[model samples]
Target: MPQTERPVSMIDPSLLLRPEKVYDDKPIEAFRDYSIDDSDPIKERVRRTYYDMHTNQTVDFVKGKMEKWLKFNHFKSTVKDALIKLNELVDESDPDSDLPNIVHAFQTAERIRQEHPDKEWMHLIGLIHDLGKVMAFYDEPQWCVVGDTFPLGCKWGPSIVYGDDSFKDNPDSYNPKYNTENGIYKPKCGLEQLMMSWGHDEYLYRMLVHNKCKFPKDGLYMIRYHSFYPWHAGGDYKHLLIDSDEEIKQAVLEFNKYDLYTKSAEVPDIEALWPYYEGLIEKYMPGVLEW
Candidate 1:
């Protein structure tokens, strides 16, 4: 496996620079608010996206997606080229910013760059973390390609956005075998043991591994579990965690703050920023990757 040049500190969350309220100057607590508001188009879009995801994303559905995408046979493109394709995507599940996903990618990388000037690997991570959403252009829908992912085949985490109402129609919600807290997993099975709902997080993480990209374990963990709000952000999956997951949780939380808060910040000049990021891509994940 490839390794990052240096270790990213997960011990102190205080080390990461944070603004008072970064999402378009919204309050910190207001960033992820999922309150129902039919009158609001963005809120309604976010609601409908999750509703479609929760209703349709069954164990079978996830398995089928895995069988399809994990093959990595659809296309091959350089990391930079793949990221450029995200210029066409807007995460329907996000109410924070309607800008193309590429802007968010650069916003995320630039913030990480400003905060942790030495961790170039993390800058690349922030840029490409959502690159798995490129699946959207290739026959995949936004519902499964973008959103906060949770463990499937288990009782939905109460902290998941709209978990109370969105999953009511899902067949897995009613299955006796899958409705338990642990579901099909053993106690303390850890994060990797669970079948998290399919999304860009897992896909890009696995892409790194399969392609032998040189990123450290912590950077990879940040990519994989950053969207697992139910565990890292929501505090709902403790019963299934082991001791080491605490370290993983801290790494993810460190990354998550930047991911969530920077959505509405001033957009960075992506053209001038490309040369810097291209060098980082060359260093960490160069060459055309199978996707």
Candidate 2:
């Protein structure tokens, strides 16, 4: 069957899922390289992280996570404090960056600020997009807190980082109800309708909503789906989408370029830039918040 395409102006839908593919002068392929290399410690770490994630992130596991975290009871802190805590986390699943997650957050936000100068909400979205990784500080494993997320209770996408080999031991892969293309979802159910695997993307998205952060729907969409590479980047899951997901997909793709491609960019002066971002926090989502 022919594939459905995202809007052409956003990004070409024909590009192969190659980490080495260049965008904005940096080789993005070098960024997401998941090639198995026991000799390369970073590559090995990336492989192991995904293998663990794919192996263990089943429907029940995600449900348990939701039950645990969705209560917003984990802890309370301002957005800046939470983001600062990420300075201690190095995303084991990422091949391109070994720097503190805080750096990547600022890199993404600053890049967005440059490109879309007037959209202050988008700049904040870039800054806090991965802020949910603060879960690592609370005892959650990196497997659940980092990396790309796909819908649970559905056939794993072929474009997922490690693909089927990594999910060999996952019970979901063998379950008839969860392994089909449509899985438990009706046709045209839309991206929002899918139960995404437990990860920072969903955590932060929900936390924002729970705390009454006032980001617009597209900003929220960018936060929630930025790491959903299989749909926005790989063109998978077309069978499950409604027509409106097209706009959501475009928003995600727009935010995703800065999220992925900025890892190699020069780190911004995070301390210097804080005053501006702090104002944004006060304006949008201020004060101590529930986890």
- Residue 81, candidate 2: how far off, in angstroms? 0.7
Off by over 4 Å in 2: 1-25
lDDT by residue for model 2 over 22-78, one digit each (tens)? 755665434566666698898789889889999999999999999999999989899
lDDT of each: 0.84, 0.86
Superposed Cα deviation of residue 254, candidate 2 (Å): 0.6
Question: Cα-based RMSD of the predictions, in order?
Answer: 8.0, 5.1
TM-score of each: 0.91, 0.92
**Regions of model 1 farther than 4 Å from truth:** 1-24
lDDT of model 1 at position 19: 53
Candidate 1 structure, TM-score to reference: 0.91
Q: Give the per-residue lDDT digits (tens) of candidate 1, residues 19-77.
A: 56435666664565566678989978988998999899999998998999888999999
The stretch of ten residues in a row with the least summed lDDT in candidate 1 is 1-10
